[model samples]
Target: MQRPNVVLIMTDQQRWDTLGCYGNEVIQTPNLDWLASEGTVFDSAYSPSPSCIPARACLLTGMDPWNTGILGMGRGGERHMGIGFEHTLPGELAKAGYHTQGVGKMHFYPQRSLNGFHHTVLDESGREEDPRFTSDYKQWFERNKTGEYGMTDHGIGWNSWMARPYHAPEFLHPTNWTVNESLKFLKQRDPSKPFFLKTSFARPHSPYDALPYFFELYMQKNLPKAQVGEWAAMHDVPKDASSTDAWRGVRSDEDIRQARAGYYGSINHIDHQIGRLLSYLKGSGLMNNTVVIFTSDHGDMLGDHHLWRKTYAYEGSAHIPLIVKLPKSMGRTVERTDAPVLLQDIMPTVMEAVGLDIPQTVDGKSVIGAMKGRSAEARDFIHGEHSTCYSEEQEMQYVTDGRVKYIWFPRIGTEQLFDLSSDPYELTDLAQRPEHREQLAAWRQRLISVLEPRSAGMTDGDRLVSQAGKPFVKSPHYAERLARFPLPF
Candidate 1:
């Protein structure tokens, strides 16, 4: 059997419900919708850790964040520097006689470290502070764009929720560049062997730089209101008039609405680019042999719960779209599955698809069996956690099985339980309800079971014990961030 080629397309900070296939009544994601109609959609997929480096590290290493040894954003001091991964997707596939190419935002430390891809074209997006920082997209922008322009030359802050159209031409956007580069790779790749290509997007993240047409499309629609739980009221107040608040702040309803407009626009723009990639594949006859997978590293809050960014245990920050399209010859077709899965599963699933080894080090199970209509849950519950980004309260952990979620804040010893089956929006907290006490306790026991073995001092004998100073940076990785090594640039 000829091994199938692989095209793994991922988005940054994109939510689960933004696509037309995900029960989103308002948004129009025609390309992604078409992909979903033809592909196998993992309806309950999530990132184990809802942050960039940690989540992506899981996708790259096929291990949970704990085993991958990247518990926080891989930045800051020596120990906080780039990833120290044991294995990588491209690295493994390249060993299996596949030509691998990586394009766009890897978010890996030392910026340019091509972990496993045979070669790469990076678009790290004005991230000059990274150790080995050079952006292929920026260079292309300089060469092809009519005038000198900062990517964020528009009045929007890099992390702002402000909505605005891109200042440059649409082709100059990194999303288009990602597609263009992948197309170039398709034309130039080694034709003798199977290929594993990854095209990752850096947008819909922030600065809300959607193309004008896309921005206008969502701005004109009757958008859904942001979910504001009664529990979210305390942190919902705007701290300042400014749109960019690193920490929790009050944002106006208008501000959130406009932010949603930009976010949806960004999603539309990415979807269009995916269409371009798909068209190229179909035209080039690769469609018959290539398996296409679409997903995001993590999700954006998009003003959900008054929270604007990721690292939260909420569905807004954790839930993501997972669409996998097997080759036409596979004779297997399922529009969607309710099976709970994670981004880490991509590693072993792709390995399984290409007839490669599924390593023992991988914490994720391959979903190939389930994709082929085999009975497998993949996981009973996914363990997710992230260290503090801005406040001590941001230090949290969670476990969920699609219908229910248990959130624990170890520092303050706070807990939230949501029955997603009835309250999909998570508007009410059932933790304090007497009727749900046993269920709450059972969820807490699950939390204890997950935390006790980690040695992070978050638990003691089946009970959560708050530790002093809040070990925001998990160790070994924490110690590495404290140590020193020469940077790339």
Candidate 2:
């Protein structure tokens, strides 16, 4: 059997329920919906650490947060630690004779670390922390500026929830550029070798600036209102509500609609670009021998539970969409699996698809068996966490098995339970109810056992300990990676 070319398309901060296939009827995602119809959708996929750097680290190394040395956001999560990873997805695949190329936001530190891809074209928006850093997308924008306004001229903060139409022409949007570059790569790739192309997009995360047509397309529809839970009243009081980038707080009905409109528009724009990529693949006769997977790093909270961004264990932030389309020659029909999976699984799954060795160092399991309609060894549950980020009370640890979830806030010792089978939006908290105490206690024990072996002392074999005020702890591997940085003169 010949190895298949692999394409991994990922988005930033995109939620699970934004696609038409996910029961979101108002959104326009025909391309993704078509792909889902022809592929297997992992219904319960999640980010093990629901943040940018940590989640990408898991995808890169096929390791969970503890093994990847990235437990949480780590106060901006911009630490230069690419040197810490001894094995990466592209690096391992490259060794197995695949020509790897990455296009779009990698979010890896050192700004331009290839992590073993033969080449990479980046779009690291506005992150010029490396003094001499500039993205390929920005460089192209500078040369092709149609007017005086730059990409950021929309005046939306990079992480802001503000919504509006993009100020520039639709062709100049970064989302369009990302797919254009990928198409160019497909046209010019080394045809002699199988290719591993990771096309990552950096939108639907914030500064929700979509093309004017797309922005209005959603605005005219009756979008679903943000669902706030009964237990979220404490956070409903406007804290930093005046800021465009407020992480927590309630917003007016009009404000939430504008934000959702922009967000849905951005996703629709990406979906249309993906349609272009799919068309090219079909036209070029590559569809039969290519393995294409689509997913996101994590999900945006999107005002759910009065939370505006990620790091929460709620379904809005932790759950992500995962669609895997196997080569047409494989003879597999469209399927949906309820098995709980994580972002790390992508590594071994891709390895299995291309007949490469699944590196022994990786903690992620391959889901190929399940994808093929066979009973694969499945996990009972997945544990996820993030250190203090937007606020001290935001530090959370959660365990879920698709049907239910339990979140524990270490900073305030608060617990939340949701029966996902009945309430997927998590509108009600069951942690305090007497009828659900037994279930909550069982879930709590599961979390305790997960944290007991960690070096952070988050749990003491018998119970979860409070971790308030203490500084964020870095895994030894991450600390060593950060230590390798050269000192300033």
Candidate 3:
């Protein structure tokens, strides 16, 4: 049989429970829901770093954060620093005679770094860090010549909690443009070669501005309220209630409602665009020969536990949705597994599915076995961490195996444990409970063993050490890459 076409569809900072397949009833994600129904869902997927740059680095290289050379959000000026990888997902596939193309937000430095794709049509969300950077979406928006409304004309800051209807028309929305470009690629792709295309969306991260119709769709519905943990009083009080972009603070009911409305609306809108893409694939008779995977770089906190943004070890930030739809020729049945999977697994999974060799440099194992219900033990657990992003106290190292999660705050030397099976929202902290002491200690030791091998001074081989928090530090490999491919800025 011919190698199946690969299409990776990703959304930025989306939560695991935001789709109907994940028990989100209020949101209209029929397209994704159908995909999940017919495919296999990894119910306990996570982002290793729980932020954009680092998580995406893992996806591209199929390596953990330590190997990816990105710890947290890059360093001070390193946010735009380029990453060097000897083997990339698209690059490896391209070598196997697949036509590789990427559309939408790559979030790469110099903005246009293709990494491995044969071609890319970018939309970096109006980010012009590089002087020569101009996204194809931005260029199209300009050339179409409609009105004075710019992409940010909605007046929403990129990472703000502010919510509103997109001031521009629906056709001009970046989500629409992303799908349109993907459909165009499908239409004109090389007929003789299998294709690997990544279609990424920038919304559901922030600037929570959906089209007016979608905004109204959820505004009229009763959205779920944000759940705060019993031990989360430290973040319940607003450090800056007046700031629209505050990362941690108590938000009013109306504020949280509006944000959820816009957020849910944006997800629903993206789902509709996905429907459009799926429709095209079916009409073109390419659906049966294609492998479709859906996931996100990371998840948004979305006011959960009074936290507003990402980079935390909490489920709201780290947990993500992972669904894989194999082609009809594979004859796979609908399946769901609670195995702990990460973004890095995608690269090897795609490689295995297309009959390519998994690169030696990759740290992630292929999940094709899990997709076929052949492997239930993907990993014992997942260790995730992030350097200080919003505050020193927020720096965390966590371990989870889907049923429970243990988080360690190095700056404060505090620990929190949650039983995710019973309390998926993490409403209670079990770290201090007497009966759960052994469980907590076991999870803590799991993290300690994982960190002991690193030179980041996180562990002393015997126990975790507390320290004053500092800005993120780049790994040696990352530093070398930045030096070789120094940013023009």
Q: Give per-model TM-scores.
A: 0.94, 0.97, 0.96
lDDT, candidate 2, at 411: 78
Q: What is the number of backbone collisions in each predicted candidate, taken in the order shown? A: 8, 0, 0
Clashing pairs in 1: 78-481, 79-480, 79-481, 79-482, 80-481, 91-116, 237-250, 238-250
Task: Count residue pairs with overlapping backbones in model 3.
Answer: 0
Tens digit of per-residue lDDT, candidate 3, span 266-308: 9999999999999998898888889899999889888888888
Give the per-residue Cα lDDT of candidate 1 at 232: 86
Q: What is candidate 2's CA lDDT for residue 465?
A: 84
- What TM-score does prediction 3 earn? 0.96
What lDDT is reached at residue 474 by model 1? 65
Candidate 2's clash total is 0
